[model samples]
Target: MKLKKNITLGLFISASVTALAWQQSGKPESFAVNGNLSGFNDSIVYLTYGTFDDTKIDSAKVTDGKFTFKGRVEEPVQGMLFSRDYKLRLDLFVDKGAVEVRGATDNLKVAGSAIVNDYALFNQEIMANRKWVNNIFTEAWNAKQSGDTARARLLEADGNKWYAYEYEIRKNYIRQHPSSPISARELLMYVNNKTLDECRPMYEALDAKVKASLQGQELTRRMELLSKIKTGNKALSFAQTAVDGQTITLNTYKGKYVLLEFWASWCGPCRAENPNLRKQMDIFGSKGFNVLGVSLDKTRDPWIKAIEKDGLTWTQVSDLKGWNNEIAVAYGVKAVPANFLIDPSGTIIAQDLRGEALNQKLKEIFK
Candidate 1:
């Protein structure tokens, strides 16, 4: 489940992130990953690492429980190694040195760099939660689709609780290891998970070297793009056809408090927040409060169905371009369930508020 080979080039499917060992770094002529598997019947080993633009994968045939990879890396990069069978995976940093891996398929020992160890530890918790939540959510969704509301609710409750727990774990780790490159990677994984003010200081605290790393540079770009839309700035205006075939423009609601929500039909978290939006809409709909939904959904059927099913009795808009929707792209919304609360004057007051937070914000504003 961890290793997914990209079909295009059979490139290494990112194990996403993994934990503990040692960190080393240098400028050797090349990097080597020599692995030893005790009883893995897999005939090949693979290494995967690269940037967003370039994903590279190398394979080595397993011979007598041993495997080796030889390559050159410009910088110490985060990567993963796994068997051709994908039953075993080790998240580690591949630097310009000889990294040795040994042990069974399940428990792997990686030694090469300090960054790799710390990186693994950070991702071990994060990636584990990602998988856990995703798996449970799939079951819950199946239950919901099969008309099993009770089971679905129970599963969703557990998933939500675990998600919060894992998020807390991430916060603690980043705060404790502000200097770790792993922290940078964690933040970059989902910028919408954090507030600009809260995450900015943490980003600033990263070591100079990390800020220059590929992850760091990308994080920097994401943060910079997000900063332009921070609270207190004027909300950007856009227009799209609402779900009901009515054209909706942000400026048309200029004199009302509006929740500019970026969501998708497929996002469970987004769907879960719809009830809260509805509740707030009822309380404030006549009090100059409104919700403008921008969905990152490409299909009309599921998009309309989700809106009607969720009882979102408010204006919703989309370009049917999914992530490529110009409105969503302009807002730099990588994460769904994202929103910006705008005051009557068209200035964003808060962002990504949900549940009790959204309730409280409307309460304070209306009062």
Candidate 2:
């Protein structure tokens, strides 16, 4: 589910880049979307263009089973056509030419630009594979609920197998279509799933034009950030206000072994791990070790309450920006309950330690 959202956002970013580039070049690019929507007449259809962060929306009223959107963009952009009733939605690539979308309102088709067509096909295949995997997962869950352990296990295995198959299909597509924007988008979508080593070759193989796009630049930046945070690298320096309204800096813990922990109140796994973390702090606090907790919560009240409830008495800080936490982003944290174990010299020695693993690492260090 997270992967699906990430892919959609990546595609939006790619299309937004094209629009922005055209805007900056002061060139006029025109687009026409002729949509023949069956079973939907005298209704409104919306055409939205831009990135996930920023967007421009336009609406056209369907008359006589058809609606047309004619506009000029700076460059080719990604857009969505959906009904006012929120029942029908189709992703589109708005390019400098005539585009045709005609089919049942629920099963729309796109035809126009080469990149757009490629992206549509890629999305169609991925969706089909995902649907298959999701069906297996549903069956597995139902079996587990019914106390059929053996059947559940078998179904779970089948789901995993299908998931792996989908992953390979995506990887192969990226490898084979390095010149397509869809390839670049797929690479960006899989960054968190694939390692930097696995992604570099595919990224480098991309066409120069694709590599220079907006999403490409963002992916490159993410790769660089990820590279800097490997196990052997120095911990990135940061400063933020603690929950108590005092300034705290990463270097303040220079002479102590520090566990730089990223978590959030909204994260169930993180909350569940709190008791174990508290135990570690109790054993390690007086032994020249400390924890610097960075909360990715969106507000202060819930964060403070969780800290108090969990009995986490170590240094705590947050910008309260949820997933956009500055320090977490710098550390390449895509998920909560993440941490870096840094030595007194500020070098990261371990990462993502949890439960018994954290305690064992601490024992080894302080024994």
**Which candidate tops TM-score?**
2
68-112, model 2: which lDDT tens digit per residue? 888876545567888777788777677777889988875678887
| lDDT (CA) per prediction | 0.76, 0.77
TM-score of each: 0.65, 0.74
Screening candidate 2 with a backbone cut-off below 3 angstroms (N, C-alpha, C), the clashing residue pairs are 22-74
Candidate 2 local lDDT, residue 124: 65
lDDT of 1 by residue, 83-129 (tens): 66678887887766788888887667777666655555455555666
Backbone clashes in model 2: 1
Error of 2 at 248 (Å): 1.5
**Model 2: residue 265 alpha-carbon error in angstroms:** 3.9
Cα miss at 141, model 1 (Å)? 23
**Model 2 C-alpha lDDT versus the unseen true structure:** 0.77
TM-score of 1: 0.65
User: Which has the greatest lDDT?
Assistant: 2
Cα RMSD of predicted structure 2: 6.8
